[model samples]
Target chain A: MNEPTRPLPRANELDTQEFWAATKNKELRYQQCDGCNTVVFYPRRHCTGCTSGNLTWKLSKGFGTVYTFSVVRQSYHPFFRGKVPYAVAWIELEEGPRILSNVIDVDDPLVDVQISMKVELVWEEHEEINIPLFKPVD
Target chain B: MKQRDAAIVGIHEYQSRDVEGKVSALQIKAESAARALEDAGLSWSDVDAIYDAGDGGGMNGLTIAEYFGLKPTVIDTTNVGGSSYEFHAAHAKRDIASGKANAALLTYGSTAHSNARAIGVGGAGGAGRHPADNMDVFSGMTLVANYAMVAHRHMHDYGTTSEQLAEISIATRCHAMRNPDAVRAMEDLEFLDIRETTIDDVTNSRMIADPLHLLECCMISDGGGAVVIASPEVAKNCRKTPVWVLGSGEATKYPQAGGDITASAGAYSGAQAFGEAGITPAEIDIAMIYDSFSITVMVLLEDLGFCKKGEGGAWVEGGRLRFDRPSDGPALNTDGGGLSSNHPGMRGIFLLIEAARQLRGESCSQVPDAKLAVAHGNGGMLGSRHAAGTIIMGRD
Candidate 1:
């Protein structure tokens, strides 16, 4: 009965706390502008669109579209070597923020990622944290 | 704009293929600064300003200033990319424009390819703090991958082939065949010279990073080059002919700004540079755009106004860069560029060097009667953070 592994968010302090806290109830959250009702990812204190500092944390539907991706076959760091050849993409969330994410649940050759493919979130647990990756919505 | 007088009167460089020391990279930069001042027929007494024309964030300016034992009127350690040197060239113009300072000297050095086991910068782009007591900064993306992705896009969108890229590399090498200043400077290769190789041949060429072959990227070295700029009045008094800075422009596009540079803001920068020079990109004779990657040269051809965007692949494929053709337009990166020239970290000065030399007819492989030459340097890769500087020189 090994404890299920959870993933970490961005390799930074601010985002890591956000990711782990959301999984306290197994939910995915993004920063939403309290004033303009705009949503942003990798939660920040202000709205990039309107320069509003009033932002609130809210759960997201976990949907996005693949804008571009790279199949990284070479690993520059030990932390990423285990996931050699993983699909890393810059996804444009449906709610309007962009994030660097991993595309999961696809078992094709390296060249299958087409631009603007609909994707949904898929969480994978690594040790103490759950990381949210994306999968084709289809 | 009312222009204050500025000119470059002195020039010096440390031409060591390999020079290593115990102190480290910063120390090398300081030492090179000292050497350049001495060779320029000037001492620390002549410099009124100094700055790192690099992408920034490292201790490059502090290092050079401290080493030379002079407090500059203007201090900057800036980095735009390979365009940094050209930026320096144009920076001299703006500095003169604002009456910021009297004379400025730009210097650069890198031991990335030094034989004495010197290390590269913490990384390429300006990001992440260095480890405790380390002078290097970390770069998130490598310049090669940046260029390759752009090259791939250029190919995907405009039918640019690896073979066409191969041709640019081959032709650049052809130019280097006669240059005495380059390591690969004297290779006798033709467009078809390297076309017969397999993917393995391209793959094994030398993976400086990834997605780019060895031949497709610039060389690294532990060397430094310097240029001196002053008011045109002062320049007329220098020992050598002062290469006038007719016009220049610098621009930056945030990495995440747009999907493609076609509709984005790069053209404004080029137009700005051309405007400052009071000439269009069409009037230029020869161009020396930064050449960290072959794709960059291709992109600059379009961006700098040589041709339209997406047409770089075909423009380069033709005999435009060929030497045998009439030297009418676009024999870009004439000194083999970073692809074939000596790319000592800050290779921008080398572009200035080649441009000045061409204007003086002092280049080893001189462009015949090349008077009004244009040399451009991009400060960062694909302009994620781009700094473009254009130098238009005349013999008269």
Candidate 2:
């Protein structure tokens, strides 16, 4: 039996296509509004701060601190059911935007993950997208 | 145009929590609507405005209106997840006060229990694709995890303990034990241990997500409810005591870049509502908070001004939320709430119903001489983006 693959972004996602494309090159991209100098994450056309349309893309060094995290012990999705006891967190990147990613490469997510812990990004290569994950800084 | 006062003249909650294969969502809506209208001493003819969250089907307001065989002039289908009905009640109050409509009806129903839906455990970024799915869903963010993250952050920030969160579950279960409907609902669920839960029971229950035990989570059930907000003219002729809509407010909150995860939209909506009502949290007699999770109620208690921020864990201690508590704080979830009563996908409508019930001195766990009430609903995920609706009501 084939393993159920995780869902990926559709090709028609025009707003985030560039962000995913950059992820393929092992680069994490976010937008900064030129009008208000506001940082926007998860890729958007307009600035969330000032609603400015003139936004510029910026590359992240992929280093951040864990703002918050939860260890999911159960999941109903076929793809995630097998990956139980995984850590999901909101990482506050040094560049000023927060992104939701998994705290990967941890021996035990429940006992290991801590808030405010420094972490650096790692990419999980997928068929269509390079998933950005993070690990605790040594 | 001069604004008139609006009151909730009728309210009805569908009694059962499991109606799978027995009734459709539309049928539940129609039935609840009829019962609520009848409770108001009115009929479908008196309803000129309709509000729904489209929990039934596409074009929800239209579908519900057509199914009920009504020609409502004003139709609203404002859906902000579980808090949709609170938003509906707020809009209906505005419409009635402005003379845009006379009698406004709000209804909701869902068959999640019968469908065997894993609402909290179901991970995000699945079949329902969105623009942000690729970014957030790949992290395996489940609905329960969203709220759990808030609990985790709360513990990290304020040293909130698992025992403090368990108090909310224990207090709600205490209220549920007195409610026959809640008792029946629990008995129907084979997987649940149908009895009043203790702190140990809540803390010891399986952890669905770290820091949030399974007992802290709201049960999945099939139920619906309806509310009728009418002008004072209509309210005077109604059968029940009028529960006046004193004030209402709605707001949305999300993980805006790096915003504080411990805070919720309730802070804005509650402040707006209490300011409009000319009262403070101390004046509230009953608080019908949406207990989607134990953490939900704890954070909302702080945001709603029942207690100071970071003090909710301490404020909820010592059985303060219990109905029989000697302290003067508001009695919480006197009808068992979503934690113990019935939570069919959307629980906002029931929040309104229970508040109205307590104001009328008809609650299963009645708070004596209850004169004021506040129903605050939190929809969507607390960890991610969500909406909050707060309605302040009074006994007339």
Candidate 3:
């Protein structure tokens, strides 16, 4: 089947290229500082914890808990014009570093959802990138 | 070095309007400066420094200086979001104390109304493929969504109800009812209407983001504000009574960079301000805390030590913020704040103006015998990359 079309993130940047590339294989990768053992997200070259440049990528267990969330009832983006009332949340990964993603498979996710609810990483194939998403574990 | 006293000797604001044939942003700045200088009984030559708190993206100080035909030795252009002017005021106080500048003029103006730019929300433009657009692209992040996330987290962690947040909007609307200069009364500005609002009204309002209703958001306005800060000697010679800058503090942190959404840098900045002022939170007579949204005030109250963390929702209940419950706290947002009054993008300067007026006994809803006032503003986002500028003002 053809990949569903959506706004795709660019993977040409020096810092975030690897993270985007990893998403193509359904992997959630974050950088681990060699000196401080700190995990960083949004693909950083240096450790935010210790400012160390010696960093390495590691695959996440892909499971996390909902830190906080909001149901985007209104959107200015033309892509989301008809897709109102979507739930978006910040997931606190088990390995550390929180990432923002949409929570699917739940009705009225904003009201029915609870903090610390278990969720796992998922992916949506778009024209240009494999977008990382999350869903509450059934 | 001993800290020399500095004070705000004059203040003025161009009414927020949206008339046809609106003048340039620089003209608004010039008019505000001229009026503020007149209010302070000073001429252009008296302004030894100029601080541009302009939100427009450019070299604000140079632009304003050239437009106003001033050649000050010092030109400060510090941009920290909505609270940039509070930071400017803090810096100006220090500059005057250190003899770097004798008279510093701080000015701000925005054409959000004239340009018809949606002041809040996500602003104009849609998400496009950018090599650097990060995770926000997929999530479809907007300003309302960001604050709603905080409200949701605050509710989950502390059991703070939506009703609690709504109370802030109600009280601010009540305050706005008393301010003739508020955006609500602006002619031809029908959307800026100020009317009686309740918890039910807030809860029933159209949801911009889950948990944040239309009532909870701040009113966008096009306004200009100016304040002249001077050394104690110059303040003594001014036309109006000088409102003393007792203390000021500023802090900046970014989200996705370890900033806590529920907690802001106001905790640190407020502590620094209160410590410098040698006063306690209870001693404050009035507070002009920024209210970009209802949750903004709730989080700030907790962070600024008005109440313990997680107690802000409870503290504001039962007409506490309206100064109705004598046992609760000081008068909050007496000038209606951004929620009901005017939010011209960045609202930091308005906070200073309101606080100065309260201390000067010039506010319409004047706190009885108001001696000390606190003005705090948060800029940026709920968690991601924010600035908090807190100022403590007093009448000595």
Q: How do the predictions measure up, each by TM-score? A: 0.79, 0.98, 0.93
Index of the highest-TM-score prediction = 2
Q: Candidates sorted by lDDT, descending order?
A: 2, 3, 1
- Candidate 1 vs 3: which has more DockQ: 3
The C-alpha stretches of model 2 lying farther than 4 A from their native spots are B1-4, B125-127
lDDT of 3: 0.80
Q: Write the per-residue lDDT of candidate 2 for residues B248-321, one digit (tens) a residue.
A: 88999867766988999999999998988888999888999999999999999999999989999999987899
lDDT for each residue of candidate 2 in A31-90, tens digit (9 for 90 to 100):
988888877776877778785468899999999999999999999889889999999899
Give the alpha carbon lDDT tens digit for every residue of A1-138 in model 3: 654334555567677888888887888888888888776776777777785458899999989988888888876566654567788788888888788778877887766667779998888876556888888887
Q: Please state how well chain A of candidate 1 matches the true chain A, as a TM-score.
A: 0.76
- Return the top candidate by DockQ: 2
If both were scored by DockQ, which would come out higher, candidate 2 or candidate 3? 2
* lDDT digits (tens) for residues A87-135 of candidate 1: 5555667666565567777776165565567899887664545556789
The DockQ figures for the candidates are: 0.20, 0.72, 0.51
In the range B1-396, model 3's lDDT, one tens digit per residue, is 123379998888777555343676677777888898998999888998998864545876676787888899888888888878889889999898888999999998876776777545552243444323555666776788888889988998899998999999988887877888864433435653447588998988899987899999987677777899999999999998888888889998655534467998899899988888888899887888889999999999999899999999889987788844434678889887787777767888888888888778788777777888889989888645689999888887
Candidate 1's TM-score = 0.79
- Could you arrange the candidates by TM-score from highest to lowest? 2, 3, 1
